[model samples]
Target: MQILEEKTLGIKSWSPEDRPREKLILKGRASLSDAELIAILLGTGTATMSAVDLAKRILLCADNNINRLAQLTVKDLVKIKGVGEAKAISIIAALELGRRRKSSDADKPAITSSKLAFDVLKSDLTDIPHEEFWIMLLNRGNRVVKKQKISLGGVSGTVADPKIIFKLALDELASGIILAHNHPSGNLEASVADLDLTRKLKEGARLLDIQILDHLIIAEDRYFSFADEGLL
Candidate 1:
């Protein structure tokens, strides 16, 4: 049914089966779309809008990117017509909890697989509106020694100096390192720049006898791994 655009009646006036809260109870949480789940968080909307209508507008503010939505600040959220400070805080709090839960799921100390590396970093980098380069230092067994940020840049690209990356790895006495960087546009394809940088870093690490295990392009929910794809 048509239910939005800030002109729908209040959620309470809708059929009980159609309300977000009731839908969750009846159909299970997985059945609701992201907007509907957020509507449940909002609780109510403005005089002219249903809760789902307000939630859709909030999602629109982030271009309907849940990852990007998680990044919006309270000050940024309250700027929306129907979003007050309390509602803004609620949105931020819920997203933060999700982030923490993802991070908490990283139970292994070793970065044994590309999926593991993605799990380790996605909580912080996924859906961000900027690019960032990070390196994971690994011991001989591929257990993580530390994760270091190399650089942060705009939406399109970020720079990672091989010197700085190696220096940190060397300092940690790392035997191998995995390269990671986020693509805010949610594109997992390795750009020309991404390939060039990976080649350069691989050669540099080879000279230092430190293995470049993989270079991952971390987009939103997935990643492109050079090693996994045999590009390394």
Candidate 2:
């Protein structure tokens, strides 16, 4: 009887008009907030709160950024009052599916300009807290063949060896390559090390009959392109 009482006053107690699933069906998914969509995954909540309320709490913890939420672990989600291991796993799984769909292989865009190249790889680098160097191997037509992480380092800097960069480009039979790294400091200004490395790699690529298309410095919301700045 106690269990039945608890169940009645949870999501089942809400009006059909107020239920997340019912609201979604009637009004369409675009009408729902991030919390509302997350509530659908939650299914139900503790006796003291509705699923929507629980989801709201979770989003609040992540500052309402889905990308930030994606970085969370199951333990992180379960730290909330109304969430348990099962509900946490469900949320993580749903977010991972969304990420995989966004970066699916069927949608690889070509690198026609520095901006286009920046758009292709920004999502992978922008939110990272440390330094990372990646090489985008491109075919003769400038279409991306592969994105390889060359190195990862601390907040200040990372090592990008020209020999390894050229070797990968040669192995892949790439005609061009775009170099990219993130500045966790949010500064778009290229450091002395950045400029020096770009020159060295450009020289190496020229020797191998491959083009060094650009070097991009990624920030949280913007980027600096060496090619765009006429520095490449």
Q: Please report, as a residue range, the 10-residue window in candidate 2 with the lowest summed lDDT.
A: 1-10
TM-score of 1: 0.71
> 73 in model 2: Cα distance from truth in Å?
4.4
Query: Where in model 1 is the C-alpha error above 4 Å?
Result: 1-68, 71-76, 104-106
Q: Model 1 over residues 1-232: C-alpha lDDT tens digits?
A: 9976655577788888888899899989999999899998899888888889899999999999987798899899999999999999999999999887876634457788888888787776775789999988889988878888899999999999998999999999999999999988878889899899999999999999999999888878888899899999
Per-candidate TM-scores read 0.71, 0.84
Give one digit per residue, the lDDT tens place, for model 2 in 62-144: 99898789878899899988899999999999987876665555668788988888777776786567899998999998899
Q: Please give the range of 10 consecutive residues that has the lowest summed lDDT in model 1.
A: 100-109
Task: Tell me, by TM-score, which candidate is best.
Answer: 2
